[model samples]
Structure formats: structure tokens, C-alpha cells
Target chain A: MSETAQRGGAIPPNSATPLVSLRDIRLTFGSHQALRGVDLDVMPGECLALLGDNAAGKSTLSKVISGTYIPDSGTITVQGEEVRFTGPNDARSRNIEMVFQDLALCDHIDVVGNLFLGRELNKGPFLDQKAMLARAQEMLEALEIRIPRLTARVEKLSGGQRQAIAIARAASFQPKVLIMDEPTSALAVAEVEAVLSLINRVKAKGVGVVLITHRLQDVFRVCDRAAIMYEGTKVAERMIADTNLEEIVNLITGGH
Target chain B: MANYTERAKQSHAVEWLNDNAQVLSIALFFIACMGFFWALTDTFMTTGNLLNVVRQGAPVLIVAVAMTFVIMTAGIDLAVGSIVALINALAAILMANGFDWVTTSVMMLAAGAVVGLAQGWFISFQGIAAFIVTLAGMSILRGIALYITEGYSIPIKDQAGFFWLGRGTLAGIPVPAILAVLVAIIGFIIMRNTRYGRQVVAVGSNLEAARRVGMPARWIVCSVYMMSGIACAIAGLLIAARLGSGSSNAAVGFEMQVIAAVVLGGTSLMGGRGSILGTALGALTILIIGNGLILMHVSPFLTQIVTGVIILLAVWMNTRLFGAGFKLGKKG
Candidate 1:
């Protein structure tokens, strides 16, 4: 194993600055307080597992970081620079990418089209389909994902393949911070292994990864630190070496 | 360890057929309609009569092309027929007041864009349903047309050049027919090859997904309405040029015909799946039925009933037979 892997997916010891830091993030929708004054930090090359039960604000917190939601009150600092995001585009410009739990793919479009999505290659006014198809193959190949057809509509692909495409799209963009919400929730055992390894591959590049998952085994396998949320607030934070599945479950279930 | 079995690979021909099933079905229907008409009426197969059908079908074909874009986004512009009538009246009025045909035509197209943009703004930015907004537009526009002309058919004398656009033939082809063909070719190219076309499909397939990816989703939605408006303007001008007059009554129930053509061509009203070629075939099919029925001495009143039934049947076949999961043979 490499030195970083030996350290349980932590950033190299010499690096002190975090890739992203969220302080006192709060959000409300109508009468419901989805998140309340949550503070978190993700260091470069570290995989942070965010754990929570239902309605524990896991998805909300990640959305705030990804700019899907602007926190009602919070300060987000990226690489020691404070920033405010008006929308997902603002966050994307800063190399922040999110793999949405719903996959957020256009079903009518083919695989190559979805892989490029908003950033399509065009020869003047026309789409450069040939170039895009070639690049899509390379993108999937680099991830070791084998999709039988690139021109097939995304709706026709299996669940694992769809999830793989979503991850491939975000990872290919060289994001500084990657947020994945329940990426393995719907995958089979083999697909989960593929995704876990893919996450490791992305982490090896020094990108800060925040994985929101209910799967405790995934946290133990890949995370350096685990933060547990209960009822819209962070209950506890533990380094992977200092935590166990039973202790994390206690934290999530509101037990001491 | 879990084993993953690859999905069986389909042959190239089968895959192509599956992908193009909707368009292919519509193509076959169009040919069947032509064959049926040719057998029933000797004149229907003649060159001159066929040219006449193309000329008459030109306006519907032009608008149907634009409607393909609108329907692709899961939107409908019910006001299109009314907009055509309004522009038809406005063009004649402008020309009567000493405005040249060229300037009048340009101004009419601009007016169409303005009208479309207004409705698009309401639907896209203000969060109104496209059906409701365009429905209201339909009533308001036609009411304006009726109020302006006061039920009069205003004649446009002189301007042989303007009349040429409606009546003139190029190499024995009617000008309007030629214009409609050009629009279809352009629409096909745009839908198949352009970035804007991809954006349209993406937005239609999943609006939230398109927005999350930073596409100008609202703007794309609005632009399609503008395209519909431009097409209506062209259709209106063609009518006025051909008739040498304009009336508030022009293109009555025209939206039904255009929408019917689009849906019949296999463009899904649900949006995201459509073909301009399918729309062209659908329009031609409708025109052939109308012209052939008349030649067969069928009552003009019964023609409406037949057209409605055919539309229902075509759309039924489109959804039930040619829809997703439809296979050509036992292998599928």
C-alpha cells in the first residue's frame, strides 16, 4: 500500500490547509430546518464519510457545499479563500463537482451526450459528435468501466452503468472537491466494489472527497474520518481509526 | 465475489431499427396513405395534382416543423393558428398603407417573435404552464385579429413580386412548397447536429438536470416559442400571398392541423422525442387524405371527421405499437 493509504485515506501530514471548510452552515425550507449551524472540514486527499439517519441533514449539508443550496447563514472557505456561491455554476467554476443521488442525467440523450452534458464540444454552431464519442470512450476506459455502446440512450443503461457515468463525468472534470450523495445505495456488491475503488482512484489525485452514504462498510473501507449527524446537527466526529460501526450507529441513533 | 453478466449485444441493423422505429413507422404510414390515395383517385397520382397538394400543404408543413421543436420541449403553442391569422391580416393592412411587401414581411416576422417571446417569458420565467399561456394567447390574438379587420377580407392589389412568393413556380415547383422544404431541411439539421438542438432535448428530458448542469434552461425553453412564432409568420405570409388578401378567418382551426401533423409524425407530446422528417411525412399524409377524399367525391364535411379519426389512429399506433420496448422480430 502507498503511504497515504496506510494512513487510512488522510491527506499527507505536511499539508495543513483544508480543500474546503464549512462553518456554522444553516438552512431552512419554509417551516422545516434542514440544517442547523453545521461545521465541517475536508482536507486534500482525504475521504470524509458523512453518516446520518433519515432527515439528519446529510443531503442538505452536501448540497450547501456543492452550491445546490445557498446556506441561510454560513461562511464557506475554499483553500483559505472565503467564497459565496449563487448557484451550481458558481461552484462549478471553482472546480467543485457533485454526483447527485438521483444521478441528474438526461434520459433522452445518448451516453456521449450525457457525459459532456453542459460542456459539449462544438465545431462552430454544430456539436462535434465524433470528437465527443472518442473522448467519452477514453473517459470510461480510464475508470475501467465497460459500456457496450456510447450512442445508446442513457435511459437504456443499467443502474450501475448510469451511476458510473455520473461519477465519470464529475471525476473527469478535475474537481478540487467531489461530493457524492449515496452513490452506492442502489448498487449491487460488484458495482459497489467498482465504485469504492473508483473513489480511491479519485482520492489518490489529492481531491477532497465527501461521501454521504448509509453503508457503514464503505466508511470503514475508504474514509479517513467519519462525521455523524442527527436531527439537523453534527453529533460527533471521529477519525476512522478511533471509530467502529457500533459507535457510529449509536451517534446516528441519538444515543450517547 | 459477485459475477456481472454483460447484456447481450444487439446486431447493428436491429439496433438501428430500434432507435429509428418511430420515424420508420411514420414513413411507412405516409407511403401507405399515398398508395391508398393513388389507387382510389387517378388524379391523385398525377404530377399537377401532386404539386397542388404540396402547395396547399406548405403552410402546415412550415408550422409543423416549428411545432416539432415546441413539442420536443414538452410544450404546445395553441396560439400558432391565431398568430398566423393576425399576421396575415397585419401584412395586408401594412401593404395597403403603402408599406412595401419586403418591409412588411420583415415587420410581420418581428411581430411574431415579439408575440412568442411574451408567451415564452410567462411560461419560462413566471412559471406558468405552456398550455395555459398559449391557450390565453390563442384567444387574445384571434380576438385582436377579429377586432382589427372587423370580419373583413382586405384585398392586396398590385405587387406582382409579393404574389410571386405564393404563386410563382421554380422549375415547375410552387414557391411555398420550395420554402417549406427548405424550412424542414434546416429544422432537421438543427435538431440533429446543433448544440441548441441538444440543449432542447436535454431540457425536455429533464429540466432540473439541465439546470443543474448550468445550461440556460429557461432561455432554451423561451427560444423554442420564438422559433414557433417565426414559423407562424412565414405560414401567414404565404397564405396572404397566395390569396391576394387577408382575413381574420384565415387558418381557422389551423393549430389542430399543425399539431395533428406533428403528433402524427411521431413527435411525442410528452417532449424529448421527435423527428422533423416524421412531421413532414405527417403533414403530407394529412394533405393527401384531404385532397384525395375530395377527388373521390366525399362530402367536404365528412373530411374533418376522417382527418380526426386518422390522427387518433396514427397517434394510437405511435404510442402503442412503435413506442419504447417495441421490437421488430422474435429476437427482440
Candidate 2:
């Protein structure tokens, strides 16, 4: 176990294979080819920022990888074993999770209930409220999100807090590769920082993260490696420390 | 200048009132209605009148509970009234054919499930518009009911125990009322506390997001229709017991009443927003209005038009008054 952990390429100096390896991924919707032979590897414990503008096929690629839409042709390998995800649940079962931009939370329900949503922790016939609440409390605490009322309806929560709950929900499943689609797009600056901090904390656990965002600042701050998507293909890949934002922006717009 | 603070406080209060105008207006209407009835009539608050109110509200409440789930997904079921008619006719015909009570009861209830499955499949899996599928279902089911009974009321004679499913009471409360409360509690648990329940609301609010999160959007959408159908079947059974017969035209205007109650309770017809509690209250409010009109000697035909206007007004108010303060996010 330690051998695999240490030899994981992006995990550490001795870490094992990349957690997610997408090779020659191609997808088209209607007449548009959203992803054109895109190739990338998400190593364990590393934050890979997928940076691009609108129509850069960032959303489409994320969906394909997360099982929202199957790739027209591609090979997705987890830990060196190729797998095909037919749907979101299939991806999730393989420990690949996506926290969508919308959060996908039920507003009428309270915090604890929303956290568990599809993957509920149950006891016999009834929902184990005590058990779920305790686990949720622990998860929130781990994420350092202070939701004063666990029973507070999600509609009543502020934007930042709701985002926190959503992130915490994704983390609850203990996913190996957590994909976030512009998780900070709707947040204020302070809320963005909060999410950034949470992302950093998750990174400490060695969970590989694929962050889909247009924010170059977030890429610089949190990501170790940045992959640029232009039109339907990956135009450039840069290490965060070695490259500046200007070149990446140029790559995104396909000028460089 | 002399009363600047006082003026400021008054303005602040008015601003606060404006912010909560939707809830405040509904409260004010309730108060005004109660006061008008109290002043004009002596027997308005009597137990007998209230019991009459419960009985009248029972059928609408049953249908609205189903509507709650449908509207939560931003979908509508127009076949409810027709479904009630069909179930009623099924029960009556089965009894006439010498079917045992338990078998007949299960068979009658199963009709709703079959209808729900058919319509739900089209709407959820087949990707048809809910309005068109249920509207077609409404026509088809009503025709089936009429054809089953030859457009006449079928008197139930053999299924004495089955009649109790609708008419039998526990302690002193009406069976339908008890059943309504039970259904509400179950609905409340599912909608407010369970994972499957949350998935329904999530899917209703935003299909793409729900799918990305690994929710079984198709199944959730389909189940809600089943729920609506079951509720309608229950209402049909109770109506048959109360009338001691089944007819094609039973609960003729029930869909309007159910939709009115759900809208009044603040469930958005646009999907992804609704509450069973609100739906129940909405049903009760409609019941109260009808009862008040009847007690005040208002004509039934006019009462329906008034009810329709009130529903329209309530929905309009929901948008105009509370739309700003309570704006729902694009996604759940």
C-alpha cells in the first residue's frame, strides 16, 4: 500500500499510476465536436486545473469524464485499468464524483438531508437521523464550515454556506478523483477564498482533484498543473510554478 | 424635523411590510374572511360545520398531495379527476361481479398504478411533455370509466369490507381525514427527510444538475406520477363509499380544486418548488372558502368561478409580491 502510495507519479516521488488517465477522448453533440481527441492525466493528490473560456468544451469534457455523457470514443483508465462509465452512477461507483456548478441540492430540505441526497446512510427501514447527523456534523467540522443550524432549510442559507455544504457533500463519499465544474463561479471573492482553502484541505488527503474553471488566479493559487482547452482540443499543458497566466490565456484563446 | 425618528420608524415598518407582502396578504385575507363570517353568521364555527368542511376538503386534499410531487418537479397531472372516476367505477363494477373485497380493492388500486406507469413512462422515459400525456390520459381514462359502467352509476353491493377502506373511522375522526393526515405525514417524511424525496425535488429543480450528481432522474420522475395516481385512487375509493355508488362523472371539477390548493400553498407549477404542508393548507383554504360560500347561501356555480379567480389571484400575488424576496436559484 505504501509502495503504491509513494510511487504514484503525481501522488509523490514514489507514487503509483495517475488516478485518472483520459487518452484520445472524443465527443460530439449534434453538429459540434465538443471534445476532440483530448488527452490528460489526473494523478493522485494533485489539483489539475482545466482552464478555458466559454465554448472551450470544458463543460462537455467534464460531463463526459463524470458519466453525464459517454464519450464518442476514448479510453479512461483508473490506476492503469481502462473503464467505461455509462452514466453518472457508474462513474461514482468507481469513486469518480462531480460537484456540478448548480450544486444539485434540494432547497426545501434542511442541510443534513441534502448532504446525503442519493447516497443515504440508512438503518433498516428508517433513515438513521442520529447517525447521519453525526456523520454530517463530523464532515462539516472537517471542512471547517460553520453552519449554525443543521436543520436550516437550504433555501435559507447564504451562497457561501450552500457552496460549502455542496463541497462537503462531494467529499462525504470519499471520492478518489473529485471533479468540480466552476465551483467558485457564483461566489463572492471571500467565498472563493473559502472554497480554495477547502480544496487545499482536501488535497492534503491525497485525493486527486480535477478543477474546471476559467479563473486563472485560482489555477495559480491552488493547482499544481494546468491543462488548457481551446475549441475542442487541449492546446497546452503547463506547470503552475513554471508558466505565467499570459501564456496560458494565449493558449486558451489559441493564439499561441 | 420635529419627528424625524418617528417618521423613520414608520417608513422602516412599511418597508418591512412590503418585503413580506405575500405572506401578510394571505394572512390578512384569512383574517378578513373569518371576521366577515363571524359577524354575519352564528353557526360558522360549529363542530358540525367544521366536520362538513373536513369532508369537503378531504377529496381535494387527497388529489393535492399527489399534485405536490408533480409540481415539485415542475410537472402537472391533469388526469386526476378522470382517474378518480375510473377507480370509483372499477370498485363498483368489481363488487357487482362478485369479486371478494380484498382482491377487488387491490385490483381497483392497481388500475391507478397501471395508468401511472403508462403515463409516467411516456412523460419521464419517453420524453413527452407532461401536459400532453396526462391530458390524453384524462380523456382516455374518462372514456374507459364511462364505457365500463355504460355511463351510469354502478351500485356496490358485495364489497362491504372494501367500503370501509373509505368510510371506516378510527376513534371518531373520519377515515378519509385520517388517511389524508397519514398520507401527509408520509409525504412530509419523503419530501423533507428522505434521500429519494430530496432527489425528486432536485430533479424537478434542475434535470442536468441532478443527472450529474448521479440521481436516478428518470425513476424519480416516474415515481411521482405513481404517487399521484395512488392518491387519486384512494380519493376515488372514499368518494365511492360516501356516495355508495360509482359514476363516470364523480369528482368532476376535482383537478381545478387540487391545482388551486397546491398553488395557494405556494408550490410553483414550474417544477422544483413545492411543499406538501403548503398543498394541504391550500386544499384546506379552498375547502373553507367553499364552505363559507355555501353557509352564506352562495350559489355553487358562482362559487366555482370565485374559486378559480382566487387561485389566479393567489398565483399572481405569489409572483408580484414575493417573487423578489424569495427568488429561487436557477438550480437547486
Candidate 3:
């Protein structure tokens, strides 16, 4: 595993100081060691594709980065400063946002409300609907996401639209490190193209993006580096240009 | 030239209809009930009869308004009747001991809030289900009232202003009805325009999502219960003032009545959707049914059966007919 070039990060190795660095992180649930001694780095303006089979700790490791799960033993440093995140809110304050695979959204809440879920715009004691509506328009337009009506409840939208809303919400947070778990898995062909382009747009803005997906072809399209995991440990990290699809597939199945 | 690349816009009228399906259906049901009663009884449509309906329905209406918020968070307060009973008994007890009406009323409201907060703390912070906590509250609070009152009704001799709250009229409208309308209006504005209202709906719709977004999700859940408690206190005071007596058995079956009204008004029992206007109308419909049944010379006990059946039918129609997917507004 150490023989591979840039065996640095299923997180990636870059010249600049990483926006986020995770070292020897471990997490166990009951008897299952979800993540065992994982090291990763998220660099600025780069896209890192986290690759592994079903139980290779991709989600668990991503959760650690997002602060949904606190590791048992490890050090997580942001921009060279070590920190302990208490919860998701802690990670959010440091400009790290995650788009969940299942898309944690309130179906009954409108698109605008979902976009501003926890951070509502209030005028005195009331919801500032007029202000929020205007801001929501700007955010949606900036992302090039087209919803017929901003006031429409999320439940009424199609799957691709809902996914678009989730991505837009996270992207609008001005996050330095954006973690997206299966951003294009449920999307239609056109929607998938939209998401890939959006990833490039976010990367162009100098934001570090970590994408976790089962679609192998996606990494070749938007990822700068690919990190492979085998049984809770990172086995290989490669520049997208340095590795072919066969080698990544072999690495994923552990040379099966 | 149509730009087929861009999504077509929906007319605002359709959107408004989609958002208001529940309220509109409830309004239709309410009007049907009103018309049914008016046809059967000559006195049903009269101004005096209408005033009596609102006046009598005021207590249930006030509690139902708060119950809409509670239900919106997918919570139920089974103890509202017991809280009302306790407050009614306590108000009389306080007044009998030489406390003025204003002081006793203030003390009763505070007690109600304390009781509600305790229950909310258990339900929200301690992770207990709202139904279980409030169910226990129903029994314990009523038991306290019965124990203190010795199963007797306490009488109030004086306090004109307090009695006026229940019986006085301004512009020929019953004071209790006016108070109920004020409560309903305040509830409407809160649910429509306030941040607290939005928080309540979001928490009810999806607690985990609300929490993930960093909203005070648990606190919002707890606060709704407090509002329910305060509403119960207000209802209890009104009852005590109107009857000129406070009894241990006051507001018995009151929780069921309020729940029925909220449900009949298209406030989903499953949570995250509610309407104060629907609730007010729901309360009125039930009150009118009771009054109309008596006027038609039907057996008094049959009114309960009829009201229960009406609630069942109304809620069934609301869900099965105008269900969540039954949007009137069409998007292009």
C-alpha cells in the first residue's frame, strides 16, 4: 500500500497546506471497526474521489470529516490548526459542509426554507419571507438550478430537483471543504451532467471537494485524485491521470 | 416563442389553492354543518343562537388553537382537560382564601406553565413520547383537583370584572366569544408569519433534519407544550367565571373535544400541518351540532355520538379525498 505514489490521501497530497487533514483516525461501532487508522487530506481547489466497496468505511470516514461522528482516536487539523468538533454545527462553523446521500430534507418545508433550514432570516420575531425569498432567488440563480417556484414544498419536486436543492444549499454556505456523498447517484442523465459541471464550478472557486460515489466513471470526469480503501484502511491514492479504470477496479476488489 | 429549456412557471392562483386545500375542505365541511343545522331548526340561523354557539364554544376553541401548534409538532396534550379542571378548582380555592381575581388568575397561569414545562421537559429533553407524558398528566392533574375539592363545586360570591370576562358583552358580542376570536387570530398570525411558527412546523415535519440544521429543535417542541398549558389555563378561567363555580369534574372529556376539533379542521394528527381558522370552525361545528341536536328535541346523550361520528367522517374525507397529493395548483 505504501509503494503507491501519493499514498498520501484517499484524502490526496498537494503542495499547499490542506484545508483539512485527518491522521490515523479510528472509529468502532459495537464490534465493527468502521474506520481503522485512516489518514486523509483535503486540499484547496481540488476534487478528491473516495473509492471503496460497500463497507470500506467511505461513509464513516466522510462522517468524521463532517463531524457527524466523533472518532475514538485521531487528530483532525483544519488549515494547520488542530481542533475537536463537538457536532455538525462545529464543522459548519469551520466552513466544512456535507451533502448527505439520503438527502436530509423536510418534505413539508418549502424550497427556500430548506435552503435556509437552520439559519433563518428573521425580522424581529417573524420569519423575513420577503428578504429570504430574494436571497433564495440569488442563491438558486448562482448555482444555475432552475425550480419553477421557490415557494414550492420540497415534497412536490422531482428527485433530481431535490438533490439540486441539497447541493445548492451546501454550496451556498461558502464552504472551504464540501463533502458530497453520492451526489449524482439518483440523478437523471442530464442531472448527472449538471452535477459534474457544478462540481467543476465549485472546484474553480478554490473550494476543496470530496466526492464519495459507487459510479467509477464519475471520478475520471471531475476528480483530480482518486483514493481507494480496502477493509477500513486506505490502500492506494493516485492522480487521476496516473491510474486507469482497471487498476482502480482491481484496487477496490483487492486484486480479485 | 417558448424557451423549452427553462421550466414553465405556475400561476399563483393554483399555488394558493394547493397550499390551502386542507383549509378550504374544512371550510366546506363547516358550511355544510351550519346549513344542515339551519335547515332542521328554525332558531339555528338566528343571531342569538349564533352568539350562544360561539360563547359556548369559546373554551374548546381557545384550547384547540394551541393544540394546532402542539399537533403541528406531532404532539398531543391529553392532559389539557385535567389542566383546565385543576386551574378551575385552584382559582376558586385561591379566591375563597381572600386572593383577588387578578392575583389568582396570574398565579393559576403560572402554575399551568410550570406543569406544562415539566411535561415538555420530559417529552423533549428526556426523550419520552408526548402521548405517554400527557396521558399520565391527565389522570394525575384531575386526581389532584378531585382530592383538593373533595369532589365538590366551589362557588364564587364576588368579582365583577372576572365574571365579566365570561359574561360581559361589547357590541352585543359575548365577551368569551370575543376572547376566543382574539386567540384564534393571534394563533393564525403566529402560524402564518412568525419564526416560532415555522420552527414548530419544521420540527414536527422532520425533527432530525431540523436538528441537523442547528435549529433549537427540542426547545421548539418544549415551547409548544407550554403554549398548550397557558391556553388550558385561559379556558379554565373562562369556565370558572361563566359558571360562577369551579368543580373537580369541570372540562371532563375536554381533551377529546379539542382533539376532535383540531382533527376535523384538517390539522393532520400526524403532525406538521395545521390551521387555526380550520380549528375555530371545527370547534364551532361541534358546538352547533350539540346545540342543534337539543333544539331538534334529540336525546342529549346522542349529541356525543353524533359529534364523534362527524369528526370521524370529516377527518376521513380530509385525508382520503384531499390528501397530500391532491394539490389544486398545477405547475407547467
Instruction: Give the best candidate by DockQ.
Output: 1
Candidate 1 lDDT by residue in tens digits, A1-256 = 6532322243233457888888778899999999877878888898999999989999999999999899999899998999999989989998999999999999889999999999999998899999999999999888777889899999878888899899999988889999999999999888888789888888999989999999999999999989888888877788899878899888789786
DockQ winner between candidates 1 and 3: 1
lDDT of 1 at A33: 95
Residue B303, candidate 1: alpha-carbon lDDT:
90
* TM-score-better candidate, 1 vs 2: 1
Cα lDDT tens digits, model 2, B1-332, are: 01001111224455455434445555565566667776777888887777657765687888888889998988899999999999999888887888876777688778788888788999999999999999999999999999988999988875666666566667766777888888888888888666677788888876876766667889889988998998888888889877788899898978888888888877777777677777776777778777787788879889988877877887787777666455322233
CAPRI-wise, candidate 3 is acceptable
Q: Write the per-residue lDDT of candidate 2 for residues A78-197, one digit (tens) a residue.
A: 888999888888888988888888887777566887787766777765677889889889998887777766765687677888888888898867889889999998987778888898
Q: What value does the lDDT take at residue B226 in candidate 2?
A: 91
Candidate order (lDDT): 1, 3, 2
Per-residue alpha-carbon lDDT of model 3 for A1-256, expressed as tens digits?
A: 3523324335334479999998888899999999878888889999999999999999999999999999999999999999999999999999999999988888888999989888889999888999999999999888777888888889888888888889889999799999999999987787788788888888999999999999999999999988788788888788999889999999899884
Count the clashes in each prediction. 0, 10, 1
DockQ of all predictions against the true structure, Cα-based: 0.55, 0.21, 0.46
Give the proportion of true interface contacts each model preserves, from 0 to 1.
0.65, 0.26, 0.50
- Ten contiguous residues with the weakest lDDT in model 2 chain B: B1-10
- On the 0 to 100 scale, the lDDT of residue A109 in model 3 is 85
- Best prediction by lDDT: 1
DockQ, Cα level, model 2: 0.21
